[model samples]
Target: MKKLLVIYWTFFKMGAVCFGGGYAMLPILERELVKKRGWTTKENLIDYYAIGQCTPGVIAVNTSTFVGNEIGGIFGGIMGTLGFITPSIIIITLIAALLSNFAHIDMVQRAFGGIRICVCALMFMAVAKLWKSAVKDMLGTVIFIMVAGCSVFLDISPVIYVILAATVGIIADKIKSTSKE
Candidate 1:
């Protein structure tokens, strides 16, 4: 019970402050889950993030669920997900109720503009960290370049890139293994 409550509170705090979606939340996730708590390694968190991206629903919520499930089974997953979303629900409700009254205010608009800038910075930091961690080998670098280029220039689905990368990774691994034998 105590563990569950702690999990809930931790994620609740994250949800409250994690602006700009999943990528922006990565630094907080790393600090709380990986560096501070030692609940999981960076590699595992990245893996969970990747999997979360591929799965249904928001990546932050899915990653929270995966980490909670890793920590405390099904109930943990439930608690984590609830904790992560509860803030959004409350905030959105309040904003919906109040934003119309303030929508025309210059200050409010400026505040939102500032917040957007901050979110962009946070997302860029997250991407830099992910790139440093994930793109190690030459193969990974090649894949990263190709994927980045394609994502920027092409209109293809992200899922297709993920699947193609996974396939390439598997084939490369098999070839490496065969060459050693």
Candidate 2:
């Protein structure tokens, strides 16, 4: 019970200030789960983030659910999900109720514009960290470049990139092993 509460509170706090999206929440999740409490490692958190991205739900909530499940169990997944979404639910509800009335205000538009800029900055920071950690070798660098270039230039789905990268990695590993042998 105590563990569940801690998981919920940690994720709740993380979700409260998390803006921009799941990637933007990475640093906060790292600080709370990996640095502050030692509940997970950076790599594991990254894995969770990856899985969350591929999953069928919001990435932040999905990552929180994975962390909570890692910390506790099914109940933890439930609590973590609930805690993470709680803020969004409340904020969206309030905003929905109030935003229409003020949607025409220039000040409101400016504030939202500023918020979007801040979110972009936050996402860039997260992406930088991920790049540093994930792109460790020449193969990783190649994959990174190819994926980024293709994603930007091509109309292909992300799943195709993931699959191609995975295949490339597996073949690269096999070649390396065979050469060493």
Specify the highest-TM-score model's number: 1
Error of 2 at 130 (Å): 2.8
**Residue pairs of candidate 2 with colliding backbone atoms:** none
* C-alpha TM-scores of all predictions: 0.60, 0.60
lDDT for model 2, on a 0 to 1 scale? Answer: 0.86
Worst 10 residues of 2 by lDDT: 20-29
- Root-mean-square deviation (CA) per prediction: 5.5, 5.3
Model 2, 1-181: lDDT tens per residue? 8988887887788778998674667888898889999988999999999988777778887887888888888999989988888888899999998999998899999999999999999789888877876889888988889898989999999988878888998999899999999
Model 2 alpha-carbon drift over 4 Å, by segment: 1-72, 114-120
Give the alpha carbon lDDT tens digit for every residue of 1-181 in model 1.
Answer: 9999988998899999999775778999999989988888999999999999778788998999999999989999999989999999999999898999997899999999999999999889888877876889999999999999999999999999988999999999999999999
Rate residue 106 of model 2 by lDDT: 98
